[model samples]
Target: MTVESPAGPSTGTSTGRRWHVLGAWLLADALALTGTRLAAVALPWLALTTTGSPTAAGVVAFAELAPLVVAKVLSGPAIDHLGARRVAVGCDAASASTVAAIPALHHLDALSFPALLVLVAATGALRGPADAARHSLVPVLAESTRQPMERVTGLASTVERTSSLVGAALAAGLVALVGAADALAVNAAGLALAAVVLGLGARSVGRGVPADDDPHSYLVRLRAGWQFLRRDPVILALTVMIAFTNLLDVAFTAVLLPVWAVETGSGVGAVGLLLAVMAATSVVGSLVAAAWADRMPRFAVYVVAFVVCGLPRFAVLAWSDVTSAPVVVMAVAGLASGFLNPVVGAVFFERIPRHLVGRVGAMSTAVAWGLMPFGGLVGSALLALLDLRAALLVAGVLYLVTTLAPVVDRRFRAMDRVPVEVS
Candidate 1:
């Protein structure tokens, strides 16, 4: 399966080795995402069940993400210096052990709120590195093929998005059929599987262990990545855009939607349907991207992706949309989300040197995702003054306004034109 690079001109020979790498990567992503999602899905349940307090459950959410921002900023260079693969394996193993402990502690009736917070925070820290490592692996997996590499990266999203969807569903089923403790155990097992897949099978597929650059000490390298981000206006602007959108999206998903459902009598079934529509459609969008990569302006496509994602909220306010109609709307948002994935991939790697990729990537995601905690809390606050409909409309207008940010920034516009040489 020889595939061309997305860059231009030459084709990369897809050897049997590359396929093996691809399979291992996909499996690793599936297992890791499954574990993460499972734990996330069951978290609120655990908090509520154990504490029987809504405020306490909310505190759990805040604690979970609080370390993410700091950890991501701090872990970048360590990932690059230490090796993304090694970091991923260790992170997965640690996460698996921590999650497994949740059940063990519960069995003894010894679990406390602080203990839960520590475990969640540890998992969050691991998540940032795991994301960077797996993402950094994409280019290595399809080393010879540019177009195929891009496609592989795009396909990786499919694995993540799908596994995430399934993991959530699986968590619910496990919780119902078994218990929260058992669901957590399953999450731990999934993490163990992820570690095993990456540790044992990846290299057989054409993956390379990056040479020990030993460039700078971990902290020095971390500072260098930050310095790079500071200098690169395009990356910085896009990062800001992503960070802000993350905040808004989290707000909508966690706080606004639930309130709307309760007010409108949509019920849990509709909520599930709404989320499914979003997830399923995002998959469709990514497929479209793979099918039509030849036709899009990569940067413009990324911008449009954000626009589509933010558009539906305005639709909700204007149309008084219910869950049924919102599914169709959310699907479009999902598709845009799909289209957006590759574009981010394109830009994120385009700016950084290969050696710095893990640190930079991990740091970037952590910083971007760190904004969500605020978004959720803000959404909770906003719901007090306005209905979900009004709050969503505000979010939509704000998102639309932000879309121009990347377009107006000269550095981002010029990124698509920069020529690069990849071996």
Candidate 2:
């Protein structure tokens, strides 16, 4: 059962230590993502309540996400040069400080709208690198453990779903008890703890490819990643498809869902509750993917999952008046969505060389998220021109069309190819 290791030959000691690293990585990811999910709920609500305008809320979202995308794009060289573990630890610490400032300034009554935007933007910038570094650790960790990428990615997705479930519930309770401003303190703590845990445990892993022998400039390395990405038809297609889908997703979560809650008189609690339901069901789907995804046809599974998750949830929200109906639809959608990352991640990691993973992965992720900064603006603009239901239906149709790309394009069939080990 021996598999090639990226760092070196797989020894018994290294194999055992890989489990430790994997556990630490997953735990840190959970903590950091939980904090992020809380902020995701708190920040929009804070903006909405404070400004009393959806446009203002959209502006606040744009302030954060625009810097985030830029930071992610620029972070590729630093990650390849400095190592993923170091970058992750440093960025997480910075993110904690920035996030803490939001609550501190709000409490002091010094948090102007502009000041709030500044803090949010700083947090987003730091978080982009931290997230990219963390994601780049996955393939190396997978190789070390001698596990299929699908299993490790599935486990990661399960952790993500569980964290979302916990984070959403905690956000509801915190917002109820302390309001949105103070609930952010919990997020700060989580980020700080993640920094500590990962810094301590993943020190020996994630060193990335050493550059001592290579004579390439940083820009050259960065350009290499971009060139490879553009040349690969499969990855290129995935990036374009995911970019559009991510834009739609951000719109749904950040703007559309919040507006729906408010308009339905459901309050912030219901928003948190619905998100929790989706995350909870998603955990089940992730578990199933972790266990059986390697045996399945990736392209078929991906298509089916996308079909199930993409348009139905929006349709339910748009058409249904019953509280229970949307919840049920969201649960089903979440379950389908859980299989997505594992399938996509395995294909992505399989194609990229170990040496280029940091730069390539970051570039791909940056492109995939490039349009997200405008997602809130798009949702807000739709709301201005059309009613809430009309906006939802419009977005849903767009989503359906976007998700159909894999079926229409032959390149995506490469996802089902047997992956050659990329050392």
Candidate 3:
């Protein structure tokens, strides 16, 4: 796959060597996310078990996610300011230390609910910088001319989604075999591994832009990213679409899937397997997208993939009353996700400026993710009100259509033929 960013200033020409750069980012990133998600999943469970309080769980989630919102929103500027490479490498190391400290605390019984919350929060704080740096790296590694950044970015998405595959299986296996605390210990090591991978291959944030660190209040600096995003039509629409999906997807993962599995009598084991299936298929799908993305019209592929994503949620609700119906529905949803991400990367990469990539990307991702707590709440509520099948289908269909509406534009449809000649 040609990992070129056509929308930005022409930087370098493509060669066969660049995809290795892409894969390295993917593997390192996969580990980064694997650590993040595993800690998210395992820490909460460990806290609940130790303290036996729902408050502990809520605090952990809040501590981690709240920083995500602020960090995400502000990270764009931070990335621009700090340089993507330093921020990426440094933050990963910070995150590793944060998670690693937890197990020792647990052993000594120093891992109180408050301490755990703070530890995870520290990890969360570092994550935003790492996230921004990685996104900036994508375009850098690719040639500005004749490079398909969407393909490269899509492969990144593959790793992001695939992290769920690695995290869940790792957490389940290690936690089940050892325990959540021990599993968390293992997760810290994985994070260190990821840090080494990306840190070793690290490049500077690129030569094209300087991080504007004019002394100012953080919010003042952060608002620059918001203002930048709001003014760009393509970016605005794409950000909205991405945020909506983020909200719905996070809800499904944290709340709905568990409920659906239990209600359907599918057992927790079967439900866990659902993600593994999703990840495996997603890897293939991402590879396909990366390999073939340059050949097709980006918009047409997006519209179709959007439908594939949306249609499956309805399948969940529509099939709720039938036994095994939930399984079939989830399978389809997994299949659809495999195809959805490439389209997402294509859309996001085509519109934004290179200099703005980290801030804009992080700002958008953070804002969208800020809705995740809401998603967790909504998913729980909907399950209480209706079955998992019904709640998910309704939410999925509504947001799916809402997001896909952006592609209805003629300008967007014409983006693919615009050529890789960066201005």
Best by lDDT: 2
Clash-forming residue pairs, model 2 = none
lDDT of 3 by residue, 1-423 (tens): 122231223337244334545556678888888876666556655654566543444455667767867776767766766667667777888788888888888789777777877887887777777776777777666553246776676677678768877777676566657777878876777777877877665332233344354676767766766777687665566566666776676566655554555466554444446655566666666777777776767667766666775657555644664435555655565555666666655655565566567767788777667776566556656656775567877777776676567566554554455435222
Query: How many clashes (backbone atoms < 3 Å, residues ≥3 apart in a chain or on different chains) does model 1 have?
Result: 9
Q: Model 2: residues >4 Å from true position, as ranges?
A: 1-14, 206-213, 419-423
lDDT of each: 0.68, 0.88, 0.65
Q: lDDT of candidate 2 vs native?
A: 0.88
92-211 per-residue lDDT for model 2 (tens digits)? 999999999988998899999999999999999999999999998888888788899999999999999999999998898899899998999999999999999999987667443454
Tell me the TM-score of each prediction against the true structure.
Answer: 0.85, 0.96, 0.81
Per-residue alpha-carbon lDDT of model 1 for 114-218, expressed as tens digits?
988888778777776666777766665546433543476678777766776677567657766777667889889988999899888764422334445555576
Q: How many residue pairs clash in each candidate?
A: 9, 0, 4
Instruction: Summing lDDT over every window of 10 consecutive residues in candidate 1, give the lowest-scoring window.
Output: 1-10
Q: Between the candidate structures 1 and 3, which one is better when assessed by TM-score?
A: 1
Candidate that beats the other on lDDT, 1 or 3, i.e. the better one: 1
